[model samples]
Target chain A: MAQLFWDDVEIGMEIPPYKKAVTLMELNRYAGANEEYVLIHMDRDYSQKVARLPDVIVMGNLKYAYLSNMMINWIGEEGTLKRLSAQYRGMDIPGPALSTEPTMICKGKVTNKYIQDGDHCIECEVWTETNEGQVTTPGSAIAILPARS
Target chain B: MAQESLITDEVRAAIGVETVSPPELVEMKAIKDYARAINWPDPPNPLHVDEEYAKKTRFGGIIAPWCFYTTLGRSAPRQRVPLPPARVGMNGGNDYEYFLPIRPGDMITTTSKIVDIVEREGRAGKLIITTSERTFTNQNGEVVGIAHGTGLSQY
Candidate 1:
């Protein structure tokens, strides 16, 4: 397979989206890794009574990390993940809900030119939406792909 | 100090102070677990699982997936600006940039500085918005990543 070169990519291209269904155990592990001992994420009772949340919630950064793979997978081997910024708009609850799966879409030309002869920076608007199709985490990124001449 | 009050003069005064966490070696176990926790298993994400397979990728060895830097750190204490005393601080947003891959055995250290902090009125009443910038470097002193985060605080 040919590496994703600058010549191959075009504006308005869409990197196929990916989805992940979050779970409670995943939330707990994420908390432990970041040393984020916040009760709203780990303790259900505290989340419900004190924090006034529905249930244990997933960490925002965890969502960022989980969703990052979509961009990583899209850029392929020779490309670099230049930048990604996430604006966490909605609160995500862990557990079985029809609304659990979050999807990331890498869409259309944020920049007109993919840098030539060296690294071509493919920029795009990246986003994650809830099952209801409401945008949750809206972000952008600049992915650099090498010119395979 | 009252909940409705503006940010303390101290918080404003302490801006630009830099703090460095102790060095920590990136671990493959932690990387694997992070991938699994995200429900990213098998097929495509083999670099986090099969060591031999990772040896073949451009990364050259087992590596934590992208955005793993968020969870990279140790319990080492660092003295930095203190937040205005508030009962709750929520995750506001994150702006991250990657320079290089974090591989197993790479000693990762972060130097962070308080860039901005301000108080504003919101529907909830008063909000203290604090922003910080973290620069991550590997043992070779090569910059691996940078992350800027904004957090909101309320009483």
Candidate 2:
């Protein structure tokens, strides 16, 4: 994989749009893998009865993992993923295309560029939006990019 | 120290020490299983790549799927014997800071330290929030990533 060179990146650059469709099977697998059997992540009946939700919801960690991979894939290895901060804003319930009223959207906007301790880097304001356009996981990250020679 | 208190020296000591586990190797099949299970679109394509496609795509190789850390984070749960009044707590939520992208062929180990503790009063009862920092290192001992997550407990 070609490391993302700083020379190729543009200020205010926008990464390619990426989408991930979460499903029941995926939620089950995640829960099973983590041994997180909380009713909210599965068992629609329990979630509705205990949590008072319309249906079982996806785990917040699932979204965090999905968005992190997408950003890493976009940046490549030349750059390092410095940080990711997110909020568990909405519940992802199972359905057809656009299950929840708002589809989860992850976006990145370049905020700053500079070098620290001899390494060139860029700061980005990253966020996730619901299909309804509600910002859910609002976060930021700093990546070390190869210096343009 | 009162049995009901969550801030005992023993608990504090457990939080202070850092723990590093042996590296675990994750193969393409295990990763693909995660994708298939999550039903994440663009799965097999992102798993492996061809020359022609590699030219067009920015990501040159099979990118590691996200949440790989969740697996690494599960290396081992802190053993806690349930006392009559103080039972082990449930995970409330995690606030993670991802430092680097985990790639294929990379052997990652999680090194963690409990950073902080906060006690609070909730409608249900008292709760404790424990924050931990888990740094992922590559085979070369290079710190590739770091994650700080919070574990919550209520009794």
lDDT leader: 1
Model 2 segments beyond 4 Å from truth?
A: A1-20, A29-38, A51-54, A76-80, A96-102, A146-149, B1-10, B20-23, B35-39, B44-63, B77-108, B122-126, B138-140
Q: Per-residue alpha-carbon lDDT of model 2 for A114-148, expressed as tens digits?
A: 87888787877777666667666666667777765
In candidate 1, what are the lDDT values of residues B89-155, reduced to their tens digit?
A: 6788888888888888888888887788888777655678888888899999999999999888765
lDDT of candidate 2 over B1-155, digit per residue (tens): 24366667666666567777778775656665665544344453344333355345555656555455666745644534222242334343444555445666778877878787767776556778777778888888787666767665655
Per-residue C-alpha lDDT of model 1 across residues A64-148, encoded as one tens digit per residue = 8755776777777777887888877777776554445443332323444455456678887777766667677888878888776
Worst 10 contiguous positions by lDDT, candidate 1 chain A: A101-110
Cα RMSD (Å) between model 1 and the true structure?
A: 3.1
Docking class of 1: medium
Which ranges in model 1 have alpha carbons more than 4 Å from their true place? A1-3, A97-112, B1-4, B40-44, B74-84
